[model samples]
Target: MTTSQNPTAQAPYKQLRRPTTDRMIAGVASGLGRYFDADPTLVRVIFAVVTVLTGGLAALTYPVIWFLMPEEPPTAPPWPTAATTAAPAAATTTPAPTMPVHGDRGPI
Candidate 1:
């Protein structure tokens, strides 16, 4: 007996992008996996097998896709720094505490 999956609901449209947050190397496999909704490990295995089978021709696609696929946007905003955030109110400069003079010795 053979079972066929009926196409019912459509998957949401996703851009072909290299994920910056979750990636191993250039993110090509991860990106393709995410785009196709498949396991990234499976994608990598397939990629390696194809690369070897195709005499490094498939491997060349890695760099090409890396160059073409845009990196996904950063998820979290950058933390506020001293320069970027508002500065505290400036306080008047205070003089250093004076020590009592000693007769050719140290502070008395």
Candidate 2:
């Protein structure tokens, strides 16, 4: 008889993402305002007041939760941004004046 587990009552597996950078049409109210942390402009004003009191049928649940939400995967701008450390260092590969010379063609 030994049962007593309560280490912060486990609750850290949230995965409702959908944020390709503060989207407005398909981020699904900022991924449900960061999965219920709220304030994505209050879930876009509660989806514009439930699509104007359900007249637009609650805006059809925002395209059915943007087709069952699952997007957040584009984070790659911290190595050195500011146009990648102030840009200007990638210009050396010029060989394309319409180069396509195959003087041996026989394909019908």
Candidate 3:
């Protein structure tokens, strides 16, 4: 049996920029989180440690990123209410025919 592929499967990843909110410092962690799909808290923790280790040079670096990085716009919901409220179309009820195998096709 052949499987149907989704038409929207090839959509590209959205470009990530700095988040506009939830920032304690300069939103640098949030920007990195968006780019890498990682937790912002973890990024912040690492940045904090690095800042300490580097004698607060990293503290100076965050503001530069804040100034340079663009802010991300808020994302919208995937579907509209009309689409969600409509009843789903009925699915085909016919059973698929089984394929006959020839000889030994080792552990297919």
Each prediction's TM-score against the native? 0.57, 0.28, 0.53
User: Model 2 scores what on Cα lDDT?
Assistant: 0.73
Q: What is the lDDT of residue 72 in candidate 1?
A: 70
Question: Which is the winner by TM-score between candidate 1 and candidate 2?
Answer: 1
Q: Considering lDDT, which of the candidate structures 1 and 3 is the better prediction for this target?
A: 1
Model 1: per-residue lDDT, tens digit, 1-108?
998864543335557778776689988898888778788899999999999999999988888899999887665233224455765546445677988676557656
Model 2 poorest ten-residue lDDT run: 75-84
TM-score between candidate 1 and the true structure: 0.57
Candidate 2 TM-score to native: 0.28
Clashing pairs in 2: none
lDDT score for residue 40 of model 1: 83
lDDT of 2 at 2: 100
- The local lDDT score (0 to 100) that residue 55 gets in candidate 2 is 95
Prediction 1 global C-alpha lDDT: 0.76
